[model samples]
Target chain A: MMSGSGDPAGLDATTLNCHELGLSFGGHKVLNGFSVTFAGAGITAVVGPNGAGKTTLFNVITGFIQPDSGECFLGDKQLTGRRPHSIARLGIGRTFQDVRFIARLSVIDNLLLASNAVSGPTGIGLRAFLSEKRIREEHSDRCAEVLETIGLTQKAGDTASTLSFGQQKLLSIGCCLMNPRKYYLLDEPFAGVHPELVVTITETLKKMSKSSEVIFIEHDFEIIEKIAERVVAIHQGHLIVDGPPDQVFDTDSVLEAFVG
Target chain B: MEYVLHILMLIVIYSVLAYSLDFIVGHGGLVSLAQAGFFGIGAYAAALLSLKFGLSLPTVFLASICLTALMSLFVSVPSFYLQDDYFVVVTFCFQMIVFSIFNNWLEVTRGALGIPGIPLPVLFGWEISSKSEFIVLGLLILAFSALCIWGLTRGAFGRILHGLREDEVYTESLGWNVRAVKIIAFAVSAVLAGLAGSLYGFYVAYIDPTYFTVMESILILSIVIVGGAGSFAGPVIGASVLVLMPEALRFIGFTPSLAGNMRELVYGLLLVLILLFRPQGIAGKYDFTQSKGAR
Candidate 1:
């Protein structure tokens, strides 16, 4: 592999920003005046109790959910009101709270599904056969790197259905890891994962943070305190805490949001 | 020899149709009942453009492919936003509408009178007049269709179809235009269906509304289900088994009309048995009864 200091795709320079994002699910007010900005090549943890709109914020930023009133941006590009795929193409990588993948697909095939090397909706019909070999070759290096990162190199050929839950979770995360995006929006990346794999995933996120922005919705405070340089806490669809990890943890409102 | 050649040519032609539908159903995890419509459209295009306008085979195929692909967007774009079963209903309607056109558009289609004497054009200086010659042409088209579909399913485009087949939203989050991919799947399948339709008309030297109905679409889908879907060998095997099995009834000493009725009964039973015992078809890796992404 050619040596590089950061993201091979050079996605580290951009920041993710959302302003006054408002949304409601049947007047439930999932997000109300929610706003946040994340810059630089470092990991930021977004923590909240259930229904606090942490995941909803990620969805809005990623364009999976449209906010009632707001705007989002990636560096300089407008993201709000755009399609999920277009927002993703704007350099935002997102994962779901409930992991989704084809159970029958091989681990490698699942990862390759998200690979940038593959062209989509090629209209040339019968002529697409000619470029198949070249596309396969171009995608090989990234696949190897992702397989190694998720520690599934040996199980690359195995069907994902056969994997354990933790392994499956890692496989889902590995989908986002397949392509290079400026910001990775992971929803509960550590939930239900084995401690051992969590440690491995932590190292991977850390390594990734040096080259790309890692913004994840996490619940566990121990890992958050250890790894997150910054933390944003939301409760009842409003931001309650935003600061260094230690400061946010010490805030009484942060405890009130969780305890109440 | 001519009769056997005729049966063999029909298999090759319908194999292209089977492969086309499999690309949408098995690969994209979509259910479309409009293959017969596109097929009929292709046949009509070929019959009308050739007998009326005297177009060449290449031009006829190209025009049919383009026209069918365009018409497919009418169903694909709107129906894809709905659920799977709703999409099927849309295709069913599309099939009905096409059948209606073939039956009632007397000025253009000659309605129920049908179009006959569809000429098989000369290709590369070869005048294809005999059933054996027609088989050669059908095999060439089948081979090309197989290669293109095989390449599509094995490549990244296939990966998109497979992934979206599993999880449309998840696939979208990966930055792929999942809707576009689904539409493309329909268009490409329709393209091949149109090609097969054109060839079928030419080979039979006849066309009518009765030839393309909702039942014909079901038959094509049955072929995919019986032969297996989602595998390169599945549709080809399916087409061979489904086509050849019905003809086997002809030698059972029953009268022609009795044998014809017997063939339909057997086709229905075979599908039921396949669904009950071997849901994946003889060569298919996918179970059609299972909901998308379940496997």
Candidate 2:
């Protein structure tokens, strides 16, 4: 958490509190009594092995899946069972584990689609259609910055499908950053990313965490240790360890889950 | 010369139809079979408004647009909830329903008797009765409609549609009201189709239930498939091929009676070849088989 514990931006404490979230698919339990309170603004790394419910927790919190029994709150707003778009509008921007931005659009267009003007109250309709030139100018600078941060400035006009897997992964993150949100849930943000650009993405995410709460699901602990202030590790649909990265890594259960 | 102009006029009208259908199919990512239904609604609305009310051409166009757009809501609202094949089914059902209404509503529509004596379009006291004048009027209408469609779909709005087509969840996560955008896309698409229909009614001055069946819907879709769907020029090119190429058979040593049968034969054969070679379309960026057809 590069922002520290100060909350110095004079921001109110908006937390994503998932209480007693239990989800079962068929006879298997994906998240059993998965509850956690993400308070304050900072970067938190959600670490877990495959099928340990890390992504499922994000899916539940983001309204893609309804928990059999649970309630999720983003500050005073209830997020559980709401439409994904409504939750996003409520300021929870997220990236999928497998990137899903529009491949047909130009690389820059993907970010532009997420611009504030595109997300305004009038929506992607007549008003925006009528004032597209002005709307495009309103956020071209920000789109440029995100593209530059993701190191894809030169490839702005190329179709997204032309990009390599890693660049597309970075574009996915770039798309998320284009729209300002209070909370960002990135599932494996650095997956398929080049080593050097991973640092670049980390810096960007770290910078964003200064004002917004950034939670990521990553398996690489070295990168997690570098960026994450708090690490919440889950195993077998339960929270095994949750504390500072050093302590959570030292926990025997966390080690056992990853190793076994 | 006049015959060529006639073919060109038909091409322009079909081009308009393809362009609007492209919005829903190419950008919106929903294959709708209800475009001809909306087209029929516009044609019927225009015929009745002009024949009965004595309204001017512009007013008739406006009324047709409103009526057709309203009718599109019946398809779009449900389409927002349906996915992929189910959505296509809904549009297919909507097409059948529109045809039924046109066929069974005998008193108002005159059943199979058809509406005749649709007046020539008049704008600012210029009667567009000649083939040349009708072609000019069609061009102007096409220009206006294409300009509006271009404006509405050039920037973020178009990208949002592409996003919605690609992945609704990803589009929703970007904070767009996917449902609302999709519904509006349908309205815009139908309005343009309605405009085409109005031009169609005034051009022919005669229309019947048979002209607006599910088969007609399939023809419009074939134009899109042969021409291409996603690109701006794809549908226009598609319309030209599907309209003019078949007609060319009449001039190329084929008797008038033989040309009619040959036209249908060539139309079907041409469509098959185009799809086999170019499933994405002649110039379309989207590969329908990969994204749409295979599903």
Candidate 3:
């Protein structure tokens, strides 16, 4: 594993800055001139109503969809109109609004799949078998570590489809841990999770914040208040407010957007 | 002895085809039904080069791979945008088109008569004229194909392919080039199928449009599904069952025609049972249910 210098400034910080990011579906604009700058590191919660285009923002950042006329930047890398996997390889890892666990695969295998990004494309059959002693040991060790962190060590061998909804959510996060990235884009990580698991997730995010930036979208403001250092509130495809969690929540416009 | 060697050679050739298809359907989650089209292109390329142009074996083989890969690009264009059932339909159309060309294009494909009397592969100065030698050649190709697949699956690229299989949308967010990876995988798989097809054409000493039909594609798919998908041993197991099933049917005291039907029946029965009970097949770690709703 190649370790970079530990200096926070020296480390290439991933900044997802959107300038006039707009997207239209069938002519009606879903996101109209939406813009926000997520800087450095720490958890930045994107809080909004059900249809505020939060997930769509994550999509545009990750290059899943093209913006009509705007730009997205990851650190110094201009990420506009690139492929999603290429964006992911550029140090951005994202979860889904719907937990996208490979339902047929074992939980550990799912994690192993994520870990492949670190190893690259040469690790398949015979070579994997020939180097099995060391590779398997490393994979097992890492998988054990992440699974234990997510409290899913016991369910490592279980098929993903067989797990409870909360466990499945944890496993999805666990998969992301196999390959450590600079930026994490989590879509509703707290959804369907139990209270205890939610605490575990919050702690995991807190730990992750020290080394990497986390931008997560969530409806539960309580959880957001617990983990988020900053919040960006969106309303109908626009950034209505951006600041620390307390101030953003106390704003009259945010209250009106939610209430009215 | 010659007949045995021929059968063995065919097995090795089909094993490569089956392995290539496994990458698309098994790992990439694209149940492509166009292996036969690519296979036909390979056979036609090799046959044309050797029979008409009088090219060497190695040259023919390389040309076959290139031609098949080029044709695969067309399949990839539409299939890349679609997934699962829609992708299958696109590939199926390509298969039909390839077959039609082979059957109707009299000037080039000989109108299904199949260029006959293909000579045995010859090295620099050595002529590999015997059937056993041909079997050895086929086995070597099969070994190479297996190694390639094994290497691919264990690498980062292979994992990305699996991730695409799991959830392509999520995979995109991980900074992986989903479209590029899909196209590369599809093209590589087509090349492998082409190699197998070229080898099969040479070993059989005859070529015909009927051999490259949709049924042939189904047989290759069945081999992958029955053995298992997404595992190294799956294709090997699938190929062995397909090869041996017919031999096993001979003990049932039926005529050759009846035996053929019985063998196919058995194959279908086995596939159905596996899909019903063990949807993941023998060595597969993941079940088919994931692919069921993946679109």
Q: Residues B1-295, candidate 1: write the lDDT tens digits.
A: 8778878987898899999999988888888899999999999999999999888888888999999999889778865577688889988999999999999999999999999888877776687788888888888889988987987888778877887778888888888877777778888899999999988888888999999999999999999999988988988888888788768887778788998888789989999999999998898888877877784
Clashing pairs in 2: B227-B238
Per TM-score, what order, best first? 1, 2, 3
On TM-score, the candidate that comes out on top is 1
Error of 2 at B14 (Å): 0.7
Q: Which candidate is the best by DockQ?
A: 2
- Candidate 1 versus the native: TM-score? 0.93
Of the true interface contacts, the fraction found in model 2 is 0.59
**How far out, in Å, is residue A134 in model 2?**
3.0
List fnat, each candidate: 0.59, 0.59, 0.42
TM-score of each: 0.93, 0.91, 0.85
- lDDT tens digits, residues A1-260, model 2? 32212222332448677777898999799998877878748899999999999999999988889999878877777788788888887788899998878887788778888774335554444544646677667878998888888889999999888888778888888888887778999999898788887888898888889878899999999999999989998887888788899999998999999997
State the lDDT of candidate 1 residue by residue for A189-245, as single tens digits: 899998999987898788778777788889999999889888989998888888888
User: Which regions of candidate 2 fall more than 4 Å away from where they truly are?
Assistant: A1-13, A125-127, A130-132, B252-258, B292-295
lDDT digits (tens) for residues B2-53 of candidate 2: 8889889999999899888988888778898998998999899888889999
lDDT string for model 3 (B178-201, tens) is: 676777788889999998888887
